[model samples]
Target: MSVEHDKALAAKGRHIALVIAATMLGWLAMSLFIGPALGLAGRYALLFDFAALAGFIYAAVNIFQLWRMRQDSQR
Candidate 1:
């Protein structure tokens, strides 16, 4: 029972961390790239590149999370 609870807590914590990380990345991209490219005033400079970076970051995080979950479950 305790183990199950611990696992759930760990999973939730990881999920929240990932969510925050993604959100922060998105905001950074918007501020530094998307907004500028769109001429939206809130721009920085890395538009298309930012988009690519965002996608890659998301994919990497998912892969890492999947690996983590798999290892945790094996235990």
Candidate 2:
């Protein structure tokens, strides 16, 4: 694979990782701190959890795609 292609893939992987990390941290903060501090409703907290799950799923799909690309390149 070309250097630029490799770099692009690496960048994408980094972006995906950052997104996953941020989503998890935000979810934790909301669940443990912000929600209670603000007296947010249980429904709102569940909504946030679902949003975080969606974000995680998105990251997982992208990571799988990137892995497939790398495998194809190896072939």
Candidate 3:
């Protein structure tokens, strides 16, 4: 790929990372405050935690993919 294309991809990756960070923060807020305020039970709260975990895993995968792409571009 051309340098310009690689740069575009890197920019996209940064945007995705920002989005993921925001989503994770939202999930954290929901799990910590919203759920309790809504009178959610432990099980329900646990579900929110699970959702956050999934988001974290997804974010990690996305970051890894971006890193790989950067490395490939360097070669």
Best by TM-score: 2
Q: Which candidate number would show the highest lDDT if scored against the true structure? A: 2
lDDT tens per residue, model 3, 1-75:
897877888787887778788878888788888888998888987787778788778878878778787788778
TM accuracy, model 1 = 0.51
lDDT (0 to 1) per candidate: 0.66, 0.94, 0.81
Which is the winner by lDDT between candidate 2 and candidate 3? 2
User: Residue 2's C-alpha lDDT in candidate 1?
Assistant: 65
- Which clashing pairs does model 2 show? none
* Stretch of 10 with least lDDT, candidate 1: 41-50
Task: Give stretches of model 1 more than 4 Å off.
Answer: 42-75
> What is candidate 2's lDDT per residue for 1-75, written digit by digit as tens?
999989989998999999999999999999889999999989989989998999999999999999998999899
Clashing pairs in 3: none
For 1-75, candidate 1 gives per-residue lDDT tens digits of: 368756975786677567657766776777776676788742344454466566667757776766686677768
RMSD each, Å: 5.8, 0.8, 2.0
Instruction: Sort the candidates on TM-score, descending order.
Output: 2, 3, 1
Locate the minimum summed-lDDT window of 10 residues in model 3: 10-19
- Stronger candidate by TM-score (1 vs 2): 2
